[model samples]
Target: MRVRLVEGASLPSYADGIRQVYADVFSEPPWNEDPSAGDRYVERLAADAARPGFTAALALGEGAVGGFATQGTVGFATAWTTPDVFPSGRSYGHVAEALGPDRVEGWLCGALEVDELAVSPDARGAGLGAALLSAVTEAAPDGRCWLLTSVHAEATLRFYRRAGWHQVPVSVPGRAGLVVLLGPGHPAARP
Candidate 1:
């Protein structure tokens, strides 16, 4: 599959397909998110696209976007800088504590944050997810990138590990099942 890195501002053209994939992938077990969640995601996506450093990769197949990965520099005057908007409220706090108060915003704001990665259920196992993941994070400032996922999604956890992502051990309050994964060059990576 050819993965195209769509600048966030240009993502509106692919919005419908991305929303369909988001609804399809997240509606299943482990996520079991409501279909309406796709609507909310689309709403947030529109806002995220306008922020600085916003980048999204779209997996193209049969003239449609089969999967997508959205990312941007954290704390870049986007809604993402606000912790309460996330599905897991404590994720921001966890990363903050793990990186320490003085360095938390500095580090995160300078690093690339993968906000969402999803492949349509019908499009899984085709490497679209991996391709999108790689393409989306390839331009991180300071070579750092990070994301959070549900620990209960064993397949997703395994996939990230297989792709060389390291899971951060920090515990997130009110989100015991969440796991933070850092890209290879992230400061928290093990030696």
Candidate 2:
């Protein structure tokens, strides 16, 4: 697989492939998201990619798009602070508590927030996901990175654990499904 970075404005060309991979992957097991959700997600991707510090990594298999991961240092802050951008204030509130609201942005301000990582079913077990993850997060300032995923995805959790991601303990009532993880050497991991 060939992995490379695609920046803002240039991202739309690959939106369809990335959307297909996203729709397929998230539609399985723990997520089960609908096609319309995927459509909406794709529609928003271009705008999201246009954010300051946005970056995307594409993994191609035999010249065809097979997997992708995206990140934007500034976009995360926008999504977190802007109302309705994420559709769930409850989840962000939980995350803020876990990361310490006052210190959260200080820690993550320039850190890459891995927005999406998806690999086509056909490319599973090929290490494309890991490669893509590594590429996108490596682009972060100071190599600090974080992402959120379904706590119920055992296989997905295992993959991330094997990749050396450290899960942050979040003990919020009613917050059972989502998880936050920090990559190795993140500043927050220091203490």
The Cα error of candidate 1 at residue 42, in Å, is 0.9
**Residue 191, candidate 2: C-alpha displacement in angstroms:** 6.3
Model 2 residue runs over 4 Å out of place are: 63-90, 172-176
Off by over 4 Å in 1: 63-90, 97-99, 102-107
Candidate 2 lDDT, 58-145, residue by residue in tens: 7765632234343321111111112222223536666766666554666555566777777777666767778788877765666577
Residue pairs in collision within model 1: none
Q: lDDT for each of the candidates?
A: 0.67, 0.65
Query: Could you give candidate 1's per-residue lDDT for residues 58-171 as a string of tens digits?
Result: 876653233544332111111122222222243676666555665455445567778888876655676777888888787776667778788889998999998899987766
